[model samples]
Target: MDTIIQPVARPSKRGSYRRHSDEFKRAVVAQSLLPDASVSRIARQHNLNANQVFAWRKLFGEGQQESGNNVCTLLPVTVVASVMAQPVAEQAPACGGIIELTVGKARLRLEGAVDTAVLHLVLQRLLP
Candidate 1:
């Protein structure tokens, strides 16, 4: 008995080809953020399918927060990075040797003059 082999079908350039660079991919993902900008427009501009652009958008959106957090940790750089990354809006004005920071409407009071050592202890307890 003889067995027949079938050739694999290739994607057609007219309906299948999609080209994207690192810069283009980032731009497309960013531009696709607006509710009005259809995925097709972004993908077409970058020679990509609507589905491809949509996927990129989703991946990048989900990753943005994690990437920002990594910058805060900066384990490979400096330990101070984590402290410095504290969001300013969450911090309350220091008064009478006390400082307050809010986390989701829950008040985190840092009492007394917050020296580096004390701050470190507080961070260890609060963050860890």
Candidate 2:
């Protein structure tokens, strides 16, 4: 007896990007969160042509700080000023700026003159 083989699947095309209101996203995500829910079926019921329901579900779940063993904390960050290096200057001037990061009751403040390279590196590592 001969067995039939399934063809390989190619990468699916991503549809156009469109912004949806927070209420709409929340509603869709809420429906998708139900037990035994199907994202495709939900999207179809909503009449959305894009394949962004899964993305929306993830986006709405951004507040979740747990991932099995590790606990990821979401911090609040505020940059009062931004500094950039001068390509021509041998030494960059001390651009004093306040960078405040707050998570719950914890707060981190970087005041006074801060190094541009260091600040850039710190932000790169900290932010998503």
Cα-based TM-score, every candidate: 0.37, 0.35
lDDT tens readout by residue for model 2, 1-128? 99999998998999887777888887887777777988788999888743687787677573442333355556645565555656745755555656677544555678877776887897666554
Instruction: Candidate 1: give its CA RMSD in angstroms.
Output: 13.8
Candidate RMSDs in Å, in order, are 13.8, 15.3
Q: lDDT of candidate 2 vs native?
A: 0.69
Candidate-wise lDDT, in order? 0.62, 0.69
Against the true structure, whose TM-score is highest? 1
Give the range of the ten consecutive residues with the poorest summed lDDT in model 2: 62-71
lDDT (10s digit) by residue, model 1, range 2-119: 9999998998667564565767777777777756877788778766778887687676663453333343432222232223444555665544554555533345666654566777
Clashes of each: 0, 0
Off by over 4 Å in 2: 1-19, 62-128
Model 1 poorest 10 in a row by lDDT: 73-82
